[model samples]
Target: MMRVLLAVLFVSAGVMHFVIEPTFTAMVPPFLPAPRVLVWISGVAEIALGLATLAPRLRPYAGWGLVALLIAVFPANVYMVFDDTPAIDAPRWALWARLPIQALLVGWAIWATEATKLVRR
Candidate 1:
């Protein structure tokens, strides 16, 4: 199911935060203080929200949380693309691709959890 798939994607990404800490830490925008702490906190949030999506009662909140998380991290994606020295070794095009991909992920969370339906009630 799409919900399960989304959960897996997020959970995997959350785990990767710790597995490749440096890459994520580097992705933090310069204006932010304590990049390492922020990375760890976001990782925990991702894992929690990802698992929350599995519970029917929690799915809507999880979906909204994902949307917020995606938006919160948007600046980092931009930083990676525009920073004087690239954060990672990724190609410029690939970095650019991530911007739109964030929108897709937001849409996916909405569709997978039917969060909009909850709003209608």
Candidate 2:
């Protein structure tokens, strides 16, 4: 059931990437080239990866992929923290607060798909 919820969360988040394009665009760090391109690419990848997590055989790989995804996109999360006006209008502390939450997200992805079991064996 946790896996199901995480999969659904990814799918919804992936779709929201497009639905909230401007906001996503705003999150991109200025140093990166083609922010729009990266936004779309990440969205599509999220959808594919999210669906892959639904299959019993694919869950482990997809779970690790999500772990990577979270790490890869973390810089933007950091950037959003310092931005004078983050698109979501989150309070300053909330922006800073989200950083540690990423670790929890990584842990949840691992547990939901039982990725740790793969590593332990």
Candidate 3:
């Protein structure tokens, strides 16, 4: 089920935030001017969002939470592409591809949550 998948995805990503803090820090938005605090906060937010998306009763709330979370994190992707932030060995375009890929993940979360109607007859 989509719910299960979303839950697992969130939990896994949450774990990564803590596990790979340094790599994550390296991806912070360059325009932010402060890297450490921003990276820490972003990591925390990812953990929170990942955990929040797991409960059945909270799926709707988590759905919206994910939407907000995605929007909030968009800046980091933008910074990665535009600000010359290191891509952790990824090619420049693959790094840029993250922006749209994020949208796909968000869409997957929405579908998994079934928060909105997708099929119109």
Local accuracy of candidate 3 as per-residue lDDT tens digits, 1-121:
6677777777676667668767777777656667767666666666666666676666666777787788887887777776554536677898789999989988977777765632331
Candidate 2 per-residue lDDT over residues 1-121, each given as its tens digit = 8888899988888998899988988988899999989999889878888898899888888999999999988999999987875476778898888899999989999988888767887
**Backbone clash numbers for all candidates listed:** 0, 0, 0
Q: Residue-wise lDDT of candidate 1 within 10-60, one digit each (tens)? A: 998999899999999999998999999999989988999999999999999
Among these predictions, the greatest lDDT belongs to 1
lDDT of each: 0.92, 0.88, 0.71
lDDT winner between 1 and 2, please give it.
Answer: 1
- Give per-residue lDDT, candidate 2, residue 8: 91
Instruction: Write the candidate numbers in order of decreasing lDDT.
Output: 1, 2, 3
How many collisions between residues are there in candidate 1?
Answer: 0
**Candidate 1: residue pairs that collide:** none
Which regions of candidate 2 are displaced past 4 Å? none
Model 1, residue 34: distance off in Å is 0.6
Q: TM-score for each prediction? A: 0.95, 0.92, 0.78
Clashing pairs in 2: none
